[model samples]
Target chain A: MEAIILQILNGLDKGSAYALIALGLTLIFGTLGVVNFAHGALFMIGAFCAVTLQRLLNLSHEVIDDTKKDFLGNPLKVDVPYLADWFGADAAQTIIQWSVPLAILFSIPIMILVGISMERGLIKHFYKRPHADQILVTFGLAIVLQEIIKAFFGANPIPTPAPPAFTGSFDFGALIGMENIIYPYWRMVYFAFAMVVIAGVFAFLQFTTFGMVVRAGMADRETVGMLGINIDRRFTIMFAIAACVAGLAGVMYTPINSPNYHMGMDFLVISFVVVVVGGMGSLPGAVLAGFVLGILEAFASMNEVIDIVPGINQIIIYLVAIIVLLTRPRGLMGRKGVMEE
Target chain B: MLGLATKDFVLLLVVAVLCLFAPVLLNPFPETSDLAQFNAGYPDLMQRFVIFGIFAIGFNILFGLTGYLSFGHAAFLGVGSYSVVWMFKLLNYNIVPGLLLSLVVSGLFALAIGYVSLRRSGIYFSILTLAFAQMSFALAYSVLTPITNGETGLQVYGNDPQYLQGDSAPNIPHLFGMTMRATETVEFGPWLWQFNAGYYFCAVVMLIAFYLAIRIFRSPFGMMLRAVKSNQQRMRYTGLNPRPYTLAAFVISGMYAGLAGGLMASMDPLAGAERMQWTASGEVVLMTILGGTGTLIGPVLGAGLIKYLENILSKINDNILHQWFAFMPDGLEDFLVAIVHPFIGKGWHLTLGLVFMAVVIFLPGGLVEGGQRIGRLFGRKKPAEAEAKAAAKTPAE
Candidate 1:
């Protein structure tokens, strides 16, 4: 029972990411009607923003320390970072420790700019084109973006540590009267952070006037346009919001599984599957499917199943997708007339 | 009209003769020369020109004609490859059974996929196909590892039960009695040209495929596909269901991919999951689009151009750039070479991307349109002006 609960906990952070990305994808599809294949790349760019911030914070002037050479080293450099100079050594360490969360403030504006430019510059032209053309062009853009990232950052995964305060795990076995059951603190922190973000998004969408208007536009863009609501502008803003959401998810995800150029590619296909299984243009469906699939995947990875059927872990999610698609076609909450051609 | 067509046919025959003896005709130049590179009658490159030509030609039947873009056609190809490999593993190395099995298996898979995928049109269809393809890929990588051999792929084992033939002869796949890579090299001056047996076999198959494609293009079924492309609702209202025709086209295209896959494995005898990735499917689409989608011969040219460039561009390096730059004034040459260097060698994809963008933006009808434009430009005036003049001459009637 404890093991199952621990597995469920382990699945939540991943589930949160899947939900966040699928939510954004569905949001864009529901409103703009563009597939937005570059969403994954946008997520990647968001993580890189955190990496960029960390790099910027650590920028230093190198000084030769002749006295510090030891154990076959030629020379030692005692560097002083700009952050250390500005905030003093201990405070700079702390600031750098919390730089990932701090990056949200920095990444939001940058991602928004990127999102707006992407929509206005490239995607705007493709809106009237066939879905195949849209998919091809966006796929091309994704390849270009990934290659650019590779050229700059190389192919290796870069590790980003959580803050020093959240580096340990908490014992849950004692609480449950079981031995040797513990959950990582960072994971729990990740779950709370995800909830906060999700709640904030929900609140913004459900309560705010802008959110209400956006929802209204999603339901009937023609009516919104007829009302002189500038539906296009709101749709563009929604694209930015979607991009930022994916980006923020990436930023938070860095500590869980190091960031790399092709990390987005690894997730892109599965996320698309998630979106399809959820329902192409349904937000709540995406959220539900994400958690359900995440838990299913966790269970599938367990030792008991592999003994019965080898390599089930790799295929369980896809098998689930196929079954759902065959039965539901529109997915769990899909409405008619969306992809009916 | 008969006289004009006869004249064109004779001209075509003469061009074909020239193409057959191209290596001998262009022997004055080194094989590595740009002109020779274009004209070289090497069997390997020629084989590829035909094989991928067949693949793209088949793809255009479904995508270009029917406007149903499948992003998972490579799954059929992978299935074909695996089937052929399995045939080689179990039975004699004769390509007859392997090829037959490839076609049958891929066709069946396509039938299943098309049935479900055709249920949803547009993006939904595309996503469904993608999901199925990924499912196949995952299964091949993990669950079906015993059959596919997972990441390392399948290799030939000499000792096996000869299912059909008696003992003393080993059961291994072969084309009659000849080796797949059997080739004869001819030397002239400093150039060496190879005439590979397997390549000629592929060439013959490609010609047959081309002929079949032409037949399909002119058939009544092809007309129905075009109608479906124009407006499916109109077709449906006319008491004609487009599903069977589209599904047939899908299956035929899948068979073509399977044949290509079988040929690949026959030549190399390895099957892997990587070939079934979405990227491979996209590549065929790219080739079809780059050459000319709706045209019969355009896809062949597109496949040849991309494959040739892929092979050649990967060979360029900084040393090659430096050598070319050595003829100019030292500083000036270095600067110019530096500017061009990044776009070559390991950066071939950057050049390919720019070319793709150019093709998409300008030559939307692909190389076929580009050819017609050039022909018109030289014949009388600018192509656009000539087109206007032709439009005036023809009238609506």
Candidate 2:
């Protein structure tokens, strides 16, 4: 029972990431009908936002004491960060605690601009081309984005600490009657934050007239156009929203997995698999499938199962995807006529 | 007509001669000059040009002729490399068994993957192939680490158990009693050029592969493939099964990929999971598409161009650009060098992207069409030439 609960928690955090990425992917697929392979890169850019903000906030004023020297004749110096000087010494040292969450505001505009530019500049031309061309072009875009980031950031993962207040684990052993049942506070925070974002996105889509129009456009773009609506403009906005969502996910993910240029690639494959398993263009299905796969992945990685199959944990997701694909061609919530000729 | 035939034959002969003497032809500066590194007209680059040409040619057969874009072809190439390395480790360093095993294993693997993936079409087909490729990559990295040697890649030590060659085998096996790397260098004036045995061996194989490709291009099977690409539904209505033909094409391409992989392993003696990544698979697609997918000779040109640019552009760092602009004023030189610096050296991808976009926009029929367009612009030629050029310019039905 304890193990199952623990696995569920593990699953939820991972599922949150997958769900967020897949949701964005589905949104792009739904609204624009363009499979944005560069969505992962957008997510990566978001994580980099946190890294950048931390670096920017940590920039310090160096004070060199020419009168002081070490045994090796090195100069002694004291550096004071701008944040520390402004807020206080204690506050300046703990700026990462604030800057990480603040990155959401910093990343949103940049991500939106990137999303808009990408849609208008490159993907706009590829819309009429074959799906293969769209994939190739977007894939090329993804590579370009990743390589540019890599050139700037180098290949190393930069660790982003959560705010000092949310840095520990919550011990659930007392309530559970188990010796140890500890869950990381940051992970719990991540789950709740994901829920809030997911709720916000769902509410924006469900309640607004914009969502209805976009959904209608998704069903039939020609009919929407016939209704004297500019579906393309709405689609571009949705793509930007999707980029923001991915960016937010990336921003929050930095504390869990240190931000790196290649992190997008690692998540992109799994998120793509998640999208496929959830059924292409199905938003709600993407969310459900992400959590399900995450839990299953958690379970597969357990010692007992791993001891039997060695690397079953890594292969299990693909095996499951293949099985799901073979059994349910349209996926769990896949609509009819989507894959139909 | 005799004159036309002679011209065509001479054109091909000239290209062959140019490739054969590329080291001499590409050497712009004398060896006695201070800039020796710039004159890197070595065997490695030459071998790479031919090897990637083979890869792209094989990829073009399936993608260009059949109009089936595979996103997992590199898995076969990686499999070929791994198989060859294993052969060297377990059997002997002899190239024959390794190459043969590479072809067989990769062909069989492709047969399995294609059998399932070909059931779908368009985006689904691409996704299916991509999934399998990722699976292969992941398995090689983690699950099959014993076979693949994980991230460090599979390699062979000198003290490997050679069952076939026994105690008589040399450290590096010979081809018909000829050393693979044995070469004679001749110095003429200020330039030194080497005629490498390995390069010639690869060149012979490449020529054979090219001949085979040309035969396939003109065969009845080739016509059927074109018909399938034109209208699969119509082909089905006519009681013709496109499945078997597509499968055959897939297998043949896989074999070609395996051959390329085997040659790579033979040249470098190592294999890694990175070779099986989707990026590598995508590269062959770029080569085929950029060069001219359906055209017989387009892929070779595309492959050679991409590989050559990768080698040259990667070596042109900021310092090299600065050196070129040294004659200008200090500020102006710095600005000029900085402007050109990003497009080369780590930023070569930006150039590649621009080229890809240009190709997709203007020359959809590829470099072949570009060539014909240039030819037409030069002035009036033979009526047959004009007509042939017109037909080539038209996108495949």
Candidate 3:
């Protein structure tokens, strides 16, 4: 029971990331009718935004301190962060500690601009082109984006810590009357944050007029356009919103997995599988399948499972996708004619 | 001659001659010249040029002729390499049996994968193949470590039992008694040319492959494959089952890829899971597209161009860049070097991506189309009329 609970908790954090990215992918697919291979790059860019903000906040100036001795026994040149001097050292320390969350605010405008520019510059010309062309161009774009990031950040994974308060693991075993079932506090925070974001998106689509039109446009673009609605403009905004969601998910994911240039590509293929399994162009389906696959993946990686079938975890998701695709070609929640051809 | 049309016969003769004398043709620069670095006459690189040429040609058969874009074809290549290595480990270090086993194994693998993946067409087919390949790669990397030797790659060891090997048999891969690494260098004046047995062997195989590809391109079977690509629904309605034709193309192409893989192993005698990665698969696709999808010579050109860039262009470092720009003013030279720095050496991928994007966007027909456009600009021939004549020549219903 304890192991099962622990696995479920472990699954949720990863599932949250999958759901967020899959949600964004499905959004772009649904609205733009595009297979955006660069969606994962957006998630990567978001994570880098957090890294950049952390680096920026911690920018240091050299100070010679006579009290501190260097390795050679001379006066030590201590590098003190400018933040420590500008704000009182305590406030600056707090700000630095909360850099990951602060990156959310920093990444939003930047992500939106990126989304808008991508839509306008490259993808705009590809709308009327073949799906193969779109995929190829976006794939090229993904590579260029990642290579650019690699140029700036180097190839190594950069560790980004969460706030001090959420760094410790919680004694979930005591709460549930099971010993030795500890879960990280930040993971729980990530889960709650994912829920809020998911709820917020769902609410935005359900309660707002703009989202209603966008949803309507998704269902029937031509008819919406016939009703004199500027569906294209609204869809562009929807694209930006999707980018923001992916970005936010990436920003929070830094503490879970260190930000690396290739992290987006690693997730890209898996998220694509999630999108396919969830049924293409289905938002709720994307979310549902994301969690389902995440849990399945977590279980597959268990030692008992590995003992039965070694390396099953590496391939279980793809196996499931193949089976699902072969058996139920439309995916879990896919519409009849969506990418059937 | 050889049952080919006059034009095709000429093309074949030209290609054969090119392959036969590539050492001299590819090495235009003298050994002592400043431009000597541009020469691609080395045995290793020449072997790769032909080997990857074979790979891209096979890929073009499936992708160009049938319009079925496979994203996992490299898995077959990897399978071929592994089979050949296993053959070398168990049997003698002869390439003939190794190559044959690789073709057979990879063909069987392709048959199974194609049977499932071909059930879906278009983007779905691509994704399905990708999934299968990724699964194969993942399995090879982890659970099959005993066979694949995990990250260190599969290699031969001294303890391996070679039942067919005699005490005097050479350790390196060979044809009968002739070693693959055997090379003869001929120097005349300032020019140095090397002829390697392995390169000649690969070049002969490539010529045969290219000839087979040409025969297939003009065959009724090729026409059917093209019909499937152009309109599968119409072909189905006309009482032709496109499935078998597509499956056959997939398998044939898979065998070609396997052959290439076997040749690779025969040259190096090692196999790694990275050969089966999706990126390697994408590299083949890039080669096919960059050269021209449906053209006979395009894939080979694409393969050669990409291999050249990867091997030669990536070798250009900052020091080379500075040296080349030394004639400029100090500030201008520094600026030029800085601008050129990121697109070479370790940054070659960025340049490749940019070039790929440009080709996809502007030259959708690939480098062949660009050539055709230039040809038309020079008033060599009326392209539309020539296309019509070519279409009329083909016995398409």
lDDT of each: 0.78, 0.81, 0.90
Runs off by more than 4 Å, candidate 3: A71-74, B381-397
Q: lDDT by residue for model 1 over B240-319, one digit each (tens)?
A: 99999999999999999988888888777788999898778878888887777677666777888888777667677777
Tell how far residue B373 is off in model 2, in angstroms. 3.4
Model 2 residue A12 distance off true place after TM-score fit, in angstroms = 2.4
Off by over 4 Å in 2: A63-77, A173-175, A339-341, B1-15, B33-40, B166-168, B381-397
Clashing pairs in 3: none
Candidate 3: deviation at residue A327, Å? 0.7
lDDT winner: 3
What is the full ranking by lDDT, best candidate first?
3, 2, 1
DockQ of 3: 0.78
Question: How would the candidate models be sorted by DockQ, starting from the highest?
Answer: 3, 1, 2
TM-score, candidate number 1:
0.89
Q: Residue A274's C-alpha lDDT in candidate 3?
A: 91
When sorted by TM-score, best at the front, the candidate numbers are 3, 2, 1
Q: Is candidate 1 or candidate 3 better by TM-score?
A: 3
lDDT, candidate 1, at A291: 81
Which TM-score value belongs to model 3?
0.96
Model 2, residue B59: what's the lDDT?
A: 87
